[model samples]
Target: MFSFSDQNGFCGRRCVWVNGPVIVGAGPSGLAVSACLKEQGIPFVVIERSDCIASLWQKRTYDRLKLHLPKKFCQLPKLEFPEEYPEYPSKKQFIAYLENYAQKFDIKPQFNECVQSAKYDDACHLWRVITVSTNGSTQSETEYICQMLVVASGENAEGVVPEIDGLKDFTGEVIHAKDYKSGEKYAGKKVLVVGCGNSGMELSLDLSNHNAKPSMVVRSSVHVLPREIMGKSTFDLATMLMKWLPLWLVDNILLILTWFILGDTQKYGIKRPSLGPLTLKNHHGKTPVLDIGTLERIRSGDIDVVGGIKRFNHTSVELVNGETLDIDSVVLATGYSSNVPYWLQETEFFAKNGFPKTPFPNGWKGKCGLYASGFTRRGLAGASADAIKISQDIAKVWKKELNHKKQKVPSHRRCISTF
Candidate 1:
């Protein structure tokens, strides 16, 4: 019901003063925070660039994609997936859940209004959220001022397709995983999927299942763990252990378990680094792929595993090990960049690589009414927890300010009567 009407104008401009926080992006993080704000009776506004909620999951993701982690670990605060749903739901089911969540909280985000820039005003002690909208031949700009600003755009804001030598020289089609839908068109064709991350592994498996001769380009060392261990979801067990055990102990125990479960990956041409999975994750913020089928595909000889790409030829790719294979298409699953620096260029909110220098799980909230959400290394659950914590913190500040104002009201009235 929020609008940019004449009555809502402020500072002689097309502005609306939001009493609560202004959250950018209507994804999981933003919705979680919105739910908390509603519970606290705080008026807030969420501006989203996409046309619908959870567009990242609803639009960009492929049809074959599913939740890598169990639904129990991925649920937001006070919102759990139905018991009828699977432990790991498909992309469509997950999107439906998010839509239901937004509806349940009556959270309506302003869609199709992309945030162009944001700045904190020192004199006013507020944030200015600038947005632009285009309708046919007309374009208009709008500004929003709020005391608290939450940037919940999430980490995968931009797709990253790594540049390689002679990429243009290839005659076949080239696309990023962001554009990949289904593997139907790739059936019977040799496709090279670059990167061994979750997307890469999953996409390669999808292609293989669709009758495509898929090969995964394992660029560097990666930890690939089985999705299930001894009849239980590895994620479920990990969560249970993480709550009680220290990180180091849990990490080492999982490493030993993986070794016993999957044996030596190097023997099958899968080389892992010397460090453990959790160590690599903590140091580099890399999520290890929980394999549901990719490992089995590799063992069954349905999918081939190759080294990193050296370069692309006419219809072939040369690997770092000097191996060349004729490929019909190439899918870059290299992953995504945070793209924070592009929007927050003036602020020290992010590093040069578009990732937060002091990322979440420690220092997501900074001074000057600036806050970050959904940038945690622990994925969805961590992002949800961060949103709830941030909303509570903002509520505490508002409470203190209201109490101070209440204390001043009685004194101000007595002084006026004396005058």
Candidate 2:
């Protein structure tokens, strides 16, 4: 898939020198890191595969998608959302904010450049990044050399759909949430929503609002919560509570509150896991859906909540609870893969699940000048903090290297070079 442009054909290799770090992806994570580097007056080249930045928010998300967390928590390092923005901004608003952030920071990423491979050269004490650029039928290759490589492709780089039995044979229509834009196209159709994550719940609600019959296939246990309780944002409350109380105590309080508000999920056949929603999120990084109106819709029977999918037939899908229903289309909100294993050469750097092995800010540091960011599952705030720390680490290395280089040069040469 890698190609280089040449006078003769498309296999030429050209070296592009980057005096500082080489960052991958121009999403929030990449831009956050770039901003931090810019603050320190560091020179880095951000390589984005897509034509524009923040492609996830720009392209993958549905038309109705909005930030689950408040705008304050979601803002990048130094930049803040407009005062006129709502508590939660829509997908487009967030993308526009990122665009503004990039422009404000003067982060001009090299667009349409897909990273082919990155390898560390211990002999040269540098990292090699090979990128391929494609324009129609033409392809160009550029090899970049830098002391550091930042992988900010984010956690959800690739969509992951579970391998359901007989899925490929189903004839109606199949699509992942990544490709789903709006429910207008699916109005009046019987849709089966797979996975009960935030995307799934929100998508189900969107379909219901558009007059589509959505039957959600809950494959496993999940946590659901109202977007607010007692006029306070649940996320905002949880963040504050975690700062003061122990996790176990916080879990119990949240459970009690959820019971008082939403009552028993089992009444509607939604299996609530033993672990508290916040506890589960902190431990496994799986977030509960911040129910806006999805719960009310589900409770009112506007949407049908079903058990795990057993299998699929041509015209219908069977549930594990021995119920079968005709489905006109299937929309998978099954989330995404970490995408770290595909690029990094060092297998030890990844976890058992194919995600990067490191955690939070530490995970930003990797083997052989390679660092992974935006995969912490901490959302925007976490990514921003991690990016800042990683940039600080890089700055330290850059300073030491500069000092070493200065020491290596003869006094007369150093004095002359200063001019």
Candidate 3:
């Protein structure tokens, strides 16, 4: 129950009862859904915390970044990358595509409105999304009451920074991979890059190209696959093989191919997981790092692949292997996590990690008209799939209500999916 007399509580805030769903992100996933909904002739309000769409790409990513996968796998719905664009579009090209997509769909997100809390109001049977916006000294709060809610804020809303022993003791600069743009500033410095995911590998490669000596930390085992095999995308090849073979067989084929192409990566301190690449990805969401010139650099000794760090000294890191290396700076390519748990005030749909409790293929829909998009670890392709499903589900219910009710306005909770 909410208090009607309270000054700063539910009743006091400016409330807008939305005619349709409220999408909580403006990234590719959100834009995809927006386009799908547009096709369905259903209106939605996209609420974005950042001033611009795809803020992660525009603000956080490195300058040398390119789509690790082929452009065909990374595009949004209703539009494809330009024909002249390369197979793996650059960071700028991808961003341009997203911007064009949003414009084509007329997806105008409410920029800078940070969602503080979103909860299902039992009394009214609607989702109450409370948001706060600030401009100069003035701050305003708005409560958006909608029939359906779409959580498209994505999995990488916040960067992860691990706490290292004696990290503060280091006198040199420390930065997360999100802040890293280029290696131009580290031309001659010895930099230690933590984590061996795509960002870590790319950062190390970039640093090496700029004449910086970089030691990349491989704390644990990770599967690394060549971006392409025999002029075909490694991922595309895997997908095709999976159609005709069992997962284990597909994994073996991939391993055999990778061996022939890149050799045994364990020799360079990078170990493969016990499960196959696709198997690991399906079960545990562990994505294999798709090599993009980083492996050659590693082979050439331009980038040093190292073991985990034991601790940080004033100007060096003590490795778990008992080796010590002096470094001028530290770049933590520690990855990112979802920010849903911070705002969404519900328990059943979203897990504590801010992902749907149900795994992908079934994670999109939840009780009380909650839906998730782009939470799938499968990247843009998964997001596009989710967007289509969500739009179809919502549109079906909405149209049914309109047809049945005739004169009555399609009431709240009408878009609830039977699934």
Candidate 4:
């Protein structure tokens, strides 16, 4: 139990209380974790920054976006999307599904609540979660002390705006992929899309379809594979191969398979770089941007593929190779950067880029009780993977605590087997 005190000088009163695990961000990953905990009869509180769960899908995604992977493999365990839904759910349908999932599980998360800071109390062995809720003209602060903390904040929240020279002087409207919604706004306008990721490619196509005359600016080579290969979804084939082959070998095979299915990308002035470690991390495995017949649109002069932006004047953008083009707007399909805003500058739990360095032990490290999911591109299955891993990790810690209380055993001796 905790007490609340009101100070006349402060804006609002604070509520202090002890609770179960505190899960932040109500995307698919957060909702899935909450569902799992519910099944285990574990009490938990889910905090979301938006008014509804999966708001990214509902708000940020483009008009024509659909899940790249098939529904059978992309859904959460023991949960099935509606039979009426297509094999590849559209962004609208996906958001509805998430809402349905929450209702089915009776997961009434505290919406409009944005987490400001989460800090661990060494003395109490509990996590203190501070949040701000804005509704109408009123704003309130709340705090929760929980035994565990799960960060389900998906990687898409913070848009990764690249450092481009002379961008600020361009005088044109510039927005990141997270701010893009529909192509209708850009209709009859010339739009430059940076990056060849799914957002870049899909948004370009969407804009073209809406008569926007969009151009894609590619800096690095991209591997554009067909949605299906050999009568099977490319995701299924990749999953099968990854199970048996090393990453390098798997990439080679995937590239070879893609070549036969989608043809080489080099013909369109786009080169496929050497397959290195896939940098685009999502829980779905790998971010697969389906060609979606956009190549034909590019060939027909409906969409232009340009190199990276070097500098931009008020009305024109110069490419790295010195090529210049005038554009009405610039949509940075640039991707996103991870952030742990609550941590202090001197905190050893975070990397220079603000991501936890631990969970990815070999290439990741961070403090215990703090975890991030949906950062690694596992693909359309990423949300499920994040949920599974976080749930398992929390269960392990919870079991250890329970055992210590019931059997007088050391936490180390009572550790739950992750395997």
Q: Which ranking of candidates, highest TM-score first? A: 2, 3, 1, 4
lDDT of 1 by residue, 1-419 (tens): 24464464443346778878899989998998888888897778999988899888887899988888889889987789989999889888888889899999899998888888888888998888888765467666678888888889888988997789988999999999989999999999999998889999999999999999999988788888989889888878877888999878888888789989888778767888777777778787888889877888898989998987888899999988998899999999989887667666345766677556685576568777777888877888888888888888889988888789778788868688687
Which of the numbered candidates is closest to the native, going by highest lDDT? 3
Q: What is the lDDT of candidate 4?
A: 0.75
Candidate 1 residue-wise lDDT at 32:
89
Indicate whether candidate 3 or candidate 4 has the larger TM-score: 3
Task: Assess candidate 1 and give its TM-score to the true structure.
Answer: 0.92
Backbone clash count for every predicted candidate, in the order shown: 0, 1, 0, 22
Best by TM-score: 2
lDDT of each: 0.84, 0.86, 0.91, 0.75
Candidate 4 per-residue lDDT, tens place, 1-419, comes to 36485556365757666456787888887888888777776778888888988878878777778887888877874489899998889888888888888988889888998888888888987788888899879998887777777777766677888888888998889998888888998989999998888788888888998889898987876667777887788777877887888767777777777777667679887787554323332222335466777877877889899987789889889998888898999999888765665432226656566555544422221365666665554533656766776777677777777766768755565576333
lDDT of 3 by residue, 194-224 (tens): 9999999999999999999999999999999
Better of 1 and 2 by lDDT: 2
lDDT of 1: 0.84
C-alpha displacement of 393 in model 2, angstroms?
Answer: 0.6
| Consecutive 10-residue window with the lowest summed lDDT within model 4 | 276-285
